[model samples]
Target: MAERRVSAGRRRHRAEWLRWGSLAAAVAVVVVFLLSQGQDIDVSYGQSPASSDAVAEGGAGELGDVTVPSVDEMAALVRADDVVRLPGAIASWDERRVREAVGDAEVRILVAPPGLDEDERDRVRDVDDATVRVIGTEVTGGIYQASADSAVGWRAQFAVGDVTDQMVALIAQLRDRPAPEAVDQFDWRDPDEAELAAVAADLRATGVHVGAGATLDGIPEDLAASAFPDRRAWYVVLPRQPFGEPVPRYGPALAELFPDTPVVVVYGWWIEYHGPHAGDFDEVVGASFYAQLGERLSLYDYPQRNVLAGYLARVTDVRYAGLFDRPLPYRPFDPLRVALPALPWLFTACVAVYLVLSARPLLRRSGAGARTGVNARLAGLTALAIEVSGLTDVSGNPSLTRAIGKLGAAGEALARNLPDRHVRSLLDDAEAELDDTARSLGRADYRPDSYLSERLA
Candidate 1:
């Protein structure tokens, strides 16, 4: 009968454990399912457009009443105007520099940048377009890039060829080409009213009408569709860091957005590493940009810049790199989970240890290990340690040290003479204060409150 009872208890214990384990597994599955339920989004970059669609399309009509300004005409206009809105960089327009560039009139130029000095403030005309305007140093293949990401990141990059007839022809063609699908709008509210009007007038004079509601997508779609094939990307400098150091974030921005157009991102140091310092040339050298989507681009060596451009084209050679609107992929918890698998193991180990420690008290069943008075023994040892270790002046307690010292001496004597007997035999510590208090209370005539105090008094 005892053996049968023991078997029945074992079966019940096993069933209880299985129930708890099943519940824990169910909770884990629910948690993982909830976490994985979200939608996925990602974009693959560097695919090429189909070869059939590779040809540049055009609906480029005549350059109507507005005469196509030759590169020199635009250059001359830039030199002669009172407030010249020439497309150039933020850094290239210091007060003394812009003043010199304008030559005579009290010239002021404004750009979309974070900081400028008191003298710099005096020079800014206004910040109408936040990205940038383009200006070419010399390449007939679209040279200047206009970055429009933001004040901190990469801005728009557009071509500003040498102020030449071919450059003018290209500009006219670009102006007439259809724009792309609408882009997110840009808010153009300048704080200063006068500055706004002046910039408005400058754009108007150049024949590019500034409609009141014009946004970043103001340029018609046809224009963009026409330039799809021949457009060469350039490095458009945007804002710098705390101290005027240029770091553009546009290549990644465009790489993520305008996957159709191969955009390039190059930094200043890249050029510094290759050849002669840019400072030696009296003119501002154009930045070399790259697009990873094109067939591996190779740069032309003569002017030295085309070499960089060439390299960009060659690398982005795969198809679909030029697709404008494709889905971005889903990526989450990859790096974190891969880098630290130990976190889950550590968490599980702690839980298991806690369950084991808690279940220890309940393990005193038929075949379970002996229910040793582990806690009671621990408490006894702790009390004994305190009685021995405390200073003689421990408040509200007296005789504790004396009794403990006598016990220690008795223990030493036992070790020497009666090695086999317990130390309690010699100490004669037959009375425990707590046990005596209980015995005293058990007696019929006990009064804890009144008699104890009176006796002490």
Candidate 2:
């Protein structure tokens, strides 16, 4: 009896090993198949690698040649009714709809012809005092200018549909602007002494020197000394009213004032930085700021404290955190490549789990009962496999039908002798299922149900 028990134990161990080995083999096959199907395996996400030179060059001198109104003319038109439509800029029908869309909002809509020449863009940029200027043209689609001195024309450009549609969408976005919870006001032009001091304190708290004045020349000596000590990166806040000119005028002027030192100039609704290290600001930080600003103007429209704090955070990230130092990983939109590799493994896992669960009853049995259960399951499975194979024509072929029925009967006979009630019931179920499948396949007029037909039912 002791020797017999040892033999049974060894057999069970071998069976477990065989089952696990089969699962590992299946997994290996799946991996090999997937690897063979594709040459390159990409497991990355986001934008592709961008060259430093391309980022540094930026999108500065790309304006095409197109006539636009002079600065004085554009300003007069903006001052007239906040809707400036150049001759032949848009169709009469579109112009009427655009005028209705403007409908007394503080926003100015400038409808220019398709292409905006360099001179024209500069002239349009010169119009200094409008709250929000939207230039709709066939060439650039839509240009959203927050201020006249905007270093970058159109914080966000929309080219979807015609110029008319773009202008209407731009106007709607500004009119229905959602106020941010952090900002209580949209006026930041002339912050009082206390407000300036608060903004200065906030800037200094973030480990950067802060300087504030009506103009760059008027900044306090002590504040200027601290902010620009040793010609390093610093922050300067100026009132929107003082800089009556566009950023192209003051941005380079400040850059010359403090040569080699990185200077961030913050005005209400406008932020510009200059220095050798400020290229990333133009490439990454500026785009990020404008994108955020376009969504919620409050970032720049709010008080200096909130706006400067937000600007400082972005500046610090680009300067120190190596935000754009590495090229972002890109995953292409090939659904087949991504989904195909995962399918075989998923199917194998499910089959493995089912096999283990179904074999549990057989594994629990000992000696002759175990053998009986195993034989019964094998016979039932063999019949089911043959029925599934669709290799033999069992329909109208009485011999093939008899063969399948006989296999099921043999399994049932073997199951009857097993002491395990669960194993006996499982074998019985298998026999019934196999019989049903055989009968279904045997019918001459049978048709399979389609996905749509079943769903409708």
Query: Which segments of candidate 1 are over 4 A away from where they belong?
Result: 2-160, 163-326, 330-373, 376-457
The residue-by-residue lDDT of candidate 2 on 103-221, one tens digit each, is 77666645554335445655666776443443332222235422211223322121111233444555555677432222111212344556545544644465243444332232233
What CA RMSD would you report for each candidate? 22.2, 17.9
Best by TM-score: 2
Candidate 1 per-residue lDDT, tens place, 265-370, comes to 3322122111112122201222222322111111110112323333333323321243222232244556534534343343233333323322333333213233
Error of model 2, residue 431, in angstroms: 6.6
Worst 10 residues of 2 by lDDT: 179-188
Candidate 1 CA-lDDT value: 0.29
Worst 10 residues of 1 by lDDT: 293-302
TM-score of each: 0.22, 0.34
